[model samples]
Structure formats: structure tokens, C-alpha cells
Target: MAFFLILFVLLLLLPDAYVWLSFVRGTSVLWSVLWWLPSGLALAALGAAAAGWFGNGLVRIFFFVLLCVAVPKLLFTVFSLLGRGIGTFVHGAAAAGHVAGIVVAVAACGAFLYGSLYGWKRLVVRQTDIVAADLPEAFDGYRIVQFSDLHVGTFGRDDRFVRALVERIVAAEPDMIVFTGDLVNASAAELDPHLRSLSRLRAPDGVYSVIGNHDYCEYGPHGSPDGAELDFEEVKRRQRELGWDVLLNESRTIRRGTDSLVLLGVENVSRPPFPSRGDLRKAMSGVGAGAFTILLSHDPSHWRREVLPETNVRLTLSGHTHAMQFRLGGFSPCGWVYSEWEGLYREGDRMLFVSSGAGGTAPFRLGAWPRIEVLTLRRGTR
Candidate 1:
């Protein structure tokens, strides 16, 4: 955390320094002094927020402000650098580069502002079909709705979005509903406002959920380790109160007539730096090897690490990546970190679907818009 904070500070400073040297230094003394004020204040607020001096809402605002300031400055620096490099060969290229940098900076500011204000609310439903040769005939057309990473703390007391989300899921008429996790950001209290609205979700099979890394309440400087554990228990208790089967290394069988398929859910599990509480072996303990099984593991990495090699679980649902909450032309920085960042991925007969998540801590998204995923299970080759 300290490394990243220092790196971020440097990123912010380098761009501002470049811009000042290239354009602001020659201006009036007053203009030059005032030029650093916005960046300075934003940095101070962000530092305070990181130190736990501000509430979640204020922290989020400062974080967004920092991003809005840094990104445009970075873009301008890039343009300025290119202009300087080209100036040796072209007579007027340096001045043109400065002009281009200013234009791009303005456009970037607008884009960041729009993303902060409205991008996170642009919800979309991503539909996918999973085909498995061993799927039972009775469960052939099962439609399961999956949503994850709500981070309800980001919503605070606003239940309108949660209510609308419930209505949308109910309208889909799914056979089952599954949440892959991160129900709350830092505390169970964050979910209090949305519990009633979330309780409205229902399906014939059931609504199942598994914990995500954030649900453990260890992300921020909220409290002590013991308090985090208490908050985690409270989160599960509230979800259960809403009629959700909060599965923790457990499996439940959903039967249709004589055919049955196992629905297993494990707690948050991932590589180092993220919590790994899932016990795949315990979760799959009693199941037959040949039975069709679907596993809900919050982190996609678990599918590769445990589910594929150890169990016959044919399908896995996950949603931790959020595609880094940004993408362009089918590319996201998340892919560099997570191989199975979003959408459906297949390897032989096994499949995994990673939702870009229904909500996130940062109230901003670009091309990788927030989404609820509807997956229909088909009993045949696609």
C-alpha cells in the first residue's frame, strides 16, 4: 500500500512538473503560484483520506478528484514530450504539440467528469449460454442470474439503485440467482440500507451467495482484525436474513424431478495479496464424481488452481476483477493481472464466467460498464 501510494504521488507530480515547465513557468508570478494549488489540495485531501481521517464518501470524492487531475496532466505530458522530440526535425511541431496537449487535456477532463457523474449507473445485462455434454436433461434450460461485487458501501443510504437492480433481476425470471460476492465494501453496516430491496430477489431454485475478498472487511483501515471478523459474520447473517443461502465451503443440490446438479459455493479464495479462505476439497466432499456441478467461487483464479484439477465441477462463476472498471476496444488492464478477468472462458469441457460486477467502490466506469450476467445452461455441445 505504501509503495503504491508513493508511486501514485510520483505519477501526479511528474506530470504537473512537466506541464509547469512547458507552459506555466513563463506566465505571471501569480499564475505560476496558483497553478499548483489544485494539485496540492487534492493530494492533501487524498493523503488524509488514506490515513482514515475522512469518511468513505469523502475518500471516494478525493480519489476521483485525484484521478481527474492526474490523468489529464499525464496525457498533456505525453503530448508535450512527443512535441519536443519531433521539434528537432520539424520547425513548428513543438508549438503544435502544446496546442494538441491542451485540447486533449480538456477532453480528458470532460470524460473523467462524465464517468464520475453517470458512468457507474449505466447498467447492462450480459447474457451467456453454457453448454456441457454431461448436464442433466431436466436442468437443460436452467437460467441462472449472477451478480457480484455490489460494494454497497459505495451506495451508502441510496436504495434506489439496489431496488432497481432487484426489479431487473426479478424481471429476468431466472430459475436460480447467484451472487459471487463483495456484498459490502468495509462493514456489514453498509448493507443495511439495501437489505430490504435485496430481499425482493427470488427464484425457484434459490438465491445463493459466496463471500468475496472485500466482504471480509480487511480492505481499508476500518477496525481491528477481530472487528473485521465480526463485521464479516454480520454480513453473512444479514444476507441469510434476506433469504440468501450464504454458502461457505458448502454445497447444495438443486433437483428437478429425478435429475439433480450440485451447486457448490466457496469463500473468497485467490493468490497472495487477496484472501484465500475457500476450501474446495471440503466444499466438494460428498458429491459423486460424475454428477454435474456448478461452483461459485468469487475469484476466477480458483477455477484454475483448485476446481479444474481437483473436482468435476463443470462451471464456475466469479466476479472479483471488475475488468479494472475500465476498458477500450475489448482491452482492459485487468487482463494483465487476471487471465480470466471478464465474460466467459472455456478450457476443454470446463467453463468459467467472470462478471464485470454489478457495483464497485469507485463510482466510475468506462467501456467496461457494470452488468448483471444471465447464464443459461444447455445440455449439449454449442
Candidate 2:
């Protein structure tokens, strides 16, 4: 809320000085009649509450019935006037030192609001018609949509944000949805507010999930401890309540006509930042080479080191890095955390797609948006 108050003050005050200095600056008698400052102060309170500084989440959002009304061109007045002096030399830029201060302050505040209030939801659209020869003739052109790393806690939560996300998932219309893991932040309480919205996730094969690094929340060495608020057992129990098939080193088959694709899933044990107790061989021990295979392990590095060369999984899907949870154009999040942070990379004929992730670790997301993936698995003849 302090963040929002500072923002409103900058927007409202800077432009006011400019507008008043101009002829539009009403005379003392004329301006005194309006009560403008009081109105602006009231609006600031609303902004603070909406930002969750002054009230509970429901009081802030997801319970609002009021339509967002248009704001007055409050800041534009000062900026429009200042725009004239910007091209000239910095010294003569403004007659008043306060005007210069206002310009700097306003610019900084606007940038801060956009930066802190926004989040990325990575919607992975997987296209797997890559190996035409490998796909069976009967099941060519199939798409499997998978999204991992929905860290539903302090930094990456808001009803407004998730409500908008639900709309995007519906738009994708995936053939099937696989949640690779780390669905909640740390505890069941963290997910409590957003359960109804997340439950709306739909797919024909259903929403399957695996546990990731943060789910345990220090219940194990692999769990997250950096400002975590929930425990491991509570997280596991809540996941079952939310309709996710928690796959712990297990395999299942999704049959199309007479052909079946072996879908293998495991916990976060085999990934970096965790022990290698995950037995990929055991997960796929009985599966035949003749069957189409899709492995849902939580780390992409698993494929590069162990899964691809050591084993023969055709395609592997994983997500632990939210793409550094920050990326812009040529810049990727890999440098900050995981070597295999985002997008598709291949080793030999095997392919892996690591999603940036759906939720964030904090409330602030500068570059990356939240995610909902629609992976299209087009089976081609290998």
C-alpha cells in the first residue's frame, strides 16, 4: 500500500503544479471552490486497498463489483507542459527546480508501478510434429500441453492475475494438460485462496502434476526455505484435494485408438538443487521401445545429462526455472539459475521444452508473464 500511495502522490501532485501554474491554474477564489485535493486523497486510499496494503485480499480484489472508472488526466497536465523543455539543454530545462524534481519523480514512479504490479504467466504451446518418421500413422498430429512451476505464494498471487490467467488457459484449448510440478508456493494455505480458480483447468486427459522444489517448503532438504510459509505434508495433502494426480516416480498410458503413449512422471528428486534418488530407469523399466514416450521430469538438465544419452526417451518436458522468472529478448534467465531455463533445446534426436512457469516466487515480475501451456503433440513416423 505504501507503494501505491507514493505512486498516486507522484501522479496527482506533479501534474497539479503544472496545471495550476498555467492559466488553467484557477484563481484563489475559483480553485478554492473545487475540493480537488480531498478527492485525490480519497482515491489514493482506494488504490492502497486494491494493492493489498490496507486490507485483506478479498477487500482488495476478487470481490469487487464496481467497474473501473476512468481517471482524470491528472498527471498529463504537468508532463505536457514539461515536454517542451525536454529537447533543450538540461540547465534551461525548467525555470523551477521543483518542476525538474517533479519530472524525475513522476517518471520513476510510473516505471515502478508498471514493474512491480505486473507478472508473467508462460503459456507453453508445444509443437511435436518434429519427427515425422517416429510418429505412428494412426496418431499423427497430436499435441500435449504441459505447464510447470506454478509457485502460488507471496510474490506470484492475486485473484485478478489468476482470473485473467484462467481466460488464457481456456483460449488455448489443449488436447491434454500436464502440470509438471511445483503447483503451490509452500503450503496448502498459500493455495487456499485460489483453489476454485485453478480447479477450472480443463483437458481431456486431465491435469496431471508432479512435485517440484518449493512444494516441500523445508520439510526435506530439497524444499524451499527462502521466505517459505508452508510445510511439505500440508502441500501434498492440499494437492490431492485440488484434483491433481501427484505422480511420484510413476508411469501411465494414454491410449488413442489401439496405440498408447507412455507418460512418465516423477518428483523433483532427480533435478539439480535436489538428490538423484529419482530412478528414470525404474520409471520406464517395463515400457516398450515400440510405445510413444513422454517423460515429465522436473528438470531439463535431467535430459541433457541422463535422460537423452544414457536413456532413450523420445521427448522430455520439465520446468523449474521460471526463465530466471525474468527475461527480455536476447537476455534469458539461464545465467541467473538453471542452465536449461527456458524453451526447446535438443540433445541428439531427443527434444526438451522447459517452460518459464505459470506463477512467480514474488509479487513482482518485471519481464516474464505467468504461464498456461498448450502442447500439441503431433505423432510422426520416426
Candidate 3:
């Protein structure tokens, strides 16, 4: 706590310190004071958090947004100014570095503002065609619309935004729809308002889903283990009421005439701290080895840790990472954290597709915007 307090203090004061130094160097006093005003406000916000004046969720969201805006501005301005200061003593190289730093700083600020104001609401459909040699010919041209991480509680006023997303998904004409996990932020109650919209999501082959870590209410308000279990069951019941087939460590065979394929869903299984309820063997128990399988497990890490070496599941879909809600070009800082952060990855004949996710805990997003994924399956060569 002390360490965090010290860091917050530094963050709250650093920009003002830079402004004061600039004022001493003949920058306008009015501009310096104006610049320092936000720092004062941020300091007050932090003090409120420290004093337990704000709700935990509100505090968390406030700090996340505050850091997102302040950190980049602070680093960009501070280092760019430092570079300019160095250029006073050095030569062309330092000046060039300063110029580059300034450009990056401006771009970062612009990106932050655009992302906060627009990116979070902007939804894009990403289409990928997958070829599986072992896929049954009967299932050729099958399309699956997969979306994950709804975190419904975060949708305070995005009802129309969400309804539009649903319409777009339906328009794609998928044979089946899959929600990898995270239908709600913590409890089944979060899905109440959005039920009507969600119920409209339909596909001929059916909508299948699995549990995510958040669905178990482990991160929600503290409650007895029995209460948590009841909430978890309620989530499953809610999904079923919305016409989704909730698969809990189980497999279902989708037959097209004489040929068939397997769809398996395991309860959320991940490394420690994340509940490891998924049992691949149990989920795949009734399936024939020859039948191509599509597995849905919320965390991508399970593919490497268990699925790859232990099973012959041809394709897996996951979405717990959310690419840390940020990415640039093909790069995600989350990539440094999770090897399988987003998009499609392959190993030998097996593949995993990690959606960046459709919703998140925060109201804003940066480079890794929300996605609706349409995956079309093909037979023969991959």
C-alpha cells in the first residue's frame, strides 16, 4: 500500500514538476498553472480512494482511466522534454531523438482520446476461414460465429450498441454460434437486462457455451462457498433460458446426414488463481478418435498446458485474455504476457483462435478493439 501510495504521489506530481521547471525556463505561468490543475484533481481522486470514499468498482475504473491518460502523457512529455534538454548540450542525434519522441507522444495522446471516446463503442467483425483435412465432408462450408467476454455489467448504456452487434451477427448467417465464456461480469443477474437482445442470437446448429472464470462469481462481492455455487448454477440456468446449450466438461455430436463432428466445452480451466474445472478427457469421453473435435475453453493457456499434448481436438476457441484490451498493428503488450493473446495460432494439425473479445471490464479500449469473429470451416488441405 505504501509503495502504491508513493508511486501515485510521484505520478500526481511529476508533470507539475516538469511544468514548474518549464515556467522557470520562461514558459507562461498561466499555462503552467492550467497544466497543473489536472494533477490537483487526480491527487484528490487518489485521496478519496485512499480514504475509502469511493466504491471499489468505481475506484478501480477511475484509476484505470486515470492511469491510461496520465501515464502516456507523463512519459511522453517528460522524456521528450528531457531529450530536448539533452539536445542543448549534444548535437543532431539528440535533436532527432527529441523529434521522434514528440511525434510518438502526440500520437499516443491522440490514440488515447480516440480510443476512450470512440474505439470502445466501435465493433468490427473479423472473418477467418479455417481448413481442416480431417473435417467431415458433410460439415464443409460450416460457419460459426464466436463471441466472448460479454461482461454484461459493463454495458451501462450500450443497449443499442449491443443490439446492433446482434443484428450484424445474425446477418452473417452462421450455421452455429458459440460463446467461449464470460457472459457476465460476475453474476447471472448481470444478464437480465440484455436477455431479450441475447435471445435473438440464433443459429441452426444451435448456440453452445461454456463457463468462464467470471461466471462463477469468484471475483464478486464475498459470499459463502454455497452462495457462490448457487450463483454459478444460476448462470447456467440463465444461459439455457436464453436458448444456449451450456456444456460443462462435455461433448455433443453434430451430425450432418451420415457424417459427424464433435463439439466439446469444458468449464473454465486455467493455471492457478483461475479455476481449473475443465476436464478434457471427461469432456471428450464419448467421442470417437476419428471424429474431428472443436473445443471451447475460455483461457487459451489450456491449449498449450493440456489440450495439445493430451488430446486430438482439431480446433479450440478461447477468449479470456481480451488481449489486455490493447494492441498495435499485430503487436499486443498482452503478447508479452500471454503467448496466445489473440487471433489464430497453430501447432501441427491443431489450431486455437483467441478472440480479442466483445466486451470488457472497462468502458474504453485502445488498439485491441472489440471483435465479432466469423470462422468458416473448409475441408481438405489446411
Candidate 4:
């Protein structure tokens, strides 16, 4: 909290400071000073909200506005400084600096606007093939459709988008389907509206799911711990009603002819600070050593902190980061936060696939765009 306060204070002052510098450098004093007002006011509101002077709703509103103003201002300030430095060094003229600064600032604003307006809605399908030497021939060519982090509360009246996503998943005709975790943001009621669209998801091998940290009501604003437990139970019940096999620290087996594959699921597990309720050993109890195994766990960190060193699970699926709902080109901020943030990561014979997630708690997204992942399992050599 203290760190954030320090960072916020710096951001709040930087833009206004840059504006003042611009005026001193012969820009119109009135226009330059006026430009700082929006950024200044937004930063003040954000700081007040962070200090708990305002309510959470107001905090969210102020934050949204702050991002809009602050991002462009920061980009302009940095680029302007660089432009001025280069122009003064090469041409010895301040006008050249001003022109470069203006062009860069305009481009930055245009990029941010485009990302906020359209990138969140640009949906795509990501496909990959995995070859496992231990996989049974009957299970070969098996396709699994994986999606995670559908913070349903954020999709208010976006039912058509939800329906379209489901339609696309079904059209791909996966043999099995898996929802890694995070079906809703905070409350069980959030999933109520999207049930129909979600129910459309179907597969020959059925859909299996595990609870995400958010699904347990850990982030709910209105609930006490006990009330949150009830909400958590309701989430599981609703998932079951949708024909999903909700696994809570348990394992099940799928048979094909004489061979079988182990399907294990552990509750959300992460290092401390994030809840670590999953019990991998308990879930894997009584499982055969020779069979191919796939585990469904919510947070990708579990694969590194627990699964890799403790078990021989061949594949694990997870989604908790949501890639911070922002990315550029193919890189995400999530990479800096987690070792195995997104996409397929392999180590020897084992692999982990982290979905960028299909739905986010926020309506804004950039290059990270939501996706549906289709993974096909093939039985062959490495």
C-alpha cells in the first residue's frame, strides 16, 4: 500500500511538472497550464479514493478516468523529453523539439483510443498440438477446448458476445472441454445471466472444471466469510446443474478400449498472499503410475511451485493472470509477474498451457484480446 502511494504521488506530479516546463520553454502559459487540469483532478480523485475518502464505486469511476488521462499524459511527457533532448543536440532549435513532441503525443493518444475501443472485442482462436508418447492410441487426436477467467459479472448485457463465444467453441467440435477456473468475478449470481450461453458448450467427453480463487467469493464486497462460503457452494451447484463435473481436489478416469487416462483436479493453489487450498497429492491418490495424466488447476504458479517437482502429471491447464488484460504485439505484463504466464510451456515430457482467458473483470483490453484455445493430443514420439 505504501509503495503504491509513493508511485501514485510521482505519477500525479510528473505530468503537471512537464506542463510547467513546457510553458517555461516558450509554449503558451495559459494553454500549457490548462492542459494539466484534467490529469491533476483525476489524480487527486484517485489518491482520495485510495486513501478511502470515497466509496469503491467512486474509486472505480475515478480510476477509469485517471487511466484515460494519465496514460496519454505520461506518454507525451516522456516522448517530449526525448524529442527535445535529440532536437537540441542535433539542430539546436526548440521548434524542432516541439514538432516532434506534438506528433508523438498524437500517435500515443490514437493508439490508446483504438486499443480501448476495439481490442477488447477482437476475439480469436488459438490452436496447438501436443504429442505424448504415453497417451493411448484411442485417445490420440483427442481435442480439448480450454477457456478460463470468465468474470461473468463484467459481461452485463453482453450476452450476444457470450453466445458468440460459445457458438465458436461448439463449432470447433472438441472431444473434451475444460474450464480452468474463474467463471465469475465475485458473486455466484454473476453467472446467472450467462448460463444459457455457457450451457451451449458441449463435447463428447464432457466438460470438467475446478474452482478459481475468485469463484470462492474471496473478492466479494458485500459478503462476510460465512456468507462467502454459501456463495462458493452456490457456484459449484450451478456448475453441476450445467452438466459440468466440478472437481474439488479429486480425480476421475476416462476409459478408451483397454487404456485409460487420469484426469485430476485440485482447487486453486498459489504461493501465500493468494489462497492455496488445492491438495495435489489427495487429488492424485489411488491413480496409476503408468497412465497419461492431465491436471486442472487455476493459477499457473502452482505448476512451478508444486506440480513440477511433486508429481508426474503430463499436462496442466490454468488461467489466473488474465495477462493483466493488456499486451503489445505478443508480449504481456503477466510475463513479468509469472514464469509461466500464458500459452504452452514445456519441460521435458511435461507441459503446461495457460490461457489468457476469455472474459475479464474489466471491459478494457489491448493486444491481449480474449481467446479460445484448442489443444489436440497426439500419441507419438517427443
Give me the candidate number with maximum TM-score: 1
Cα-based lDDT at residue 294, candidate 4: 96
Determine which window of 10 residues in candidate 2 has minimal summed lDDT.
62-71
TM-score of each: 0.95, 0.64, 0.85, 0.88
Error of 1 at 37 (Å): 3.6
Candidate 3, residue 45: how far the Cα is off, in Å: 7.5
- Identify the runs in model 2 with alpha carbons over 4 angstroms from their true place: 1-113, 121-132, 155-157, 219-231, 270-277, 380-382
Task: Give lDDT per model, in order.
Answer: 0.87, 0.62, 0.82, 0.81
Determine the backbone clash count of candidate 3.
Answer: 0
Cα displacement (Å) at residue 330, model 2: 2.1
Runs of candidate 1 with Cα error greater than 4 angstroms are: 1-3, 26-34, 222-225
lDDT of 2 by residue, 1-382 (tens): 5796688566655555555566455577558434355445455555664553433332223112111111223434544456556635575545554455556556644543454454343333344444535655555656666767766665334565666666667667766678877766545566777777877877777667777776766422223454243466767667677676677788888887887777888777554346444677778878887777788888777776788777677778888777765567757647555666777776656788887777655443445655665666554434
Compared with the true structure, what per-residue lDDT tens digits does model 4 show for residues 1-382? 6797779778866866785776544667777667767666666766575564543344444545555666666766776676667776777545655666567667766765665566667788999898888889999988999988887777765586788889989999998899999988778888877898888788988999998988987665553548878998999999998999999999989888888898999998987677778999999999988868999999999998888998999999999988887888778878888988888899999999999998776666677888899999999986
lDDT string for model 1 (1-382, tens) is: 7898789888888888977886789899998778787678778878676676655776576658666777888888899889988999999898888889989988988887777778888888888889898899999889999999988899889888888888889999999999999998888888888888998999999999999999998756655658878888899999999999999999999999999999999999988888889998899899888888899999998888888887778899999998988888889999899888999999899999999998888788878888989899998987
Poorest lDDT segment (10 consecutive residues) of candidate 3: 52-61
Better of 2 and 4 by TM-score: 4
Task: Give candidate 3's TM-score.
Answer: 0.85
Model 4 misplaced stretches (Cα beyond 4 Å): 20-67, 84-94, 223-225
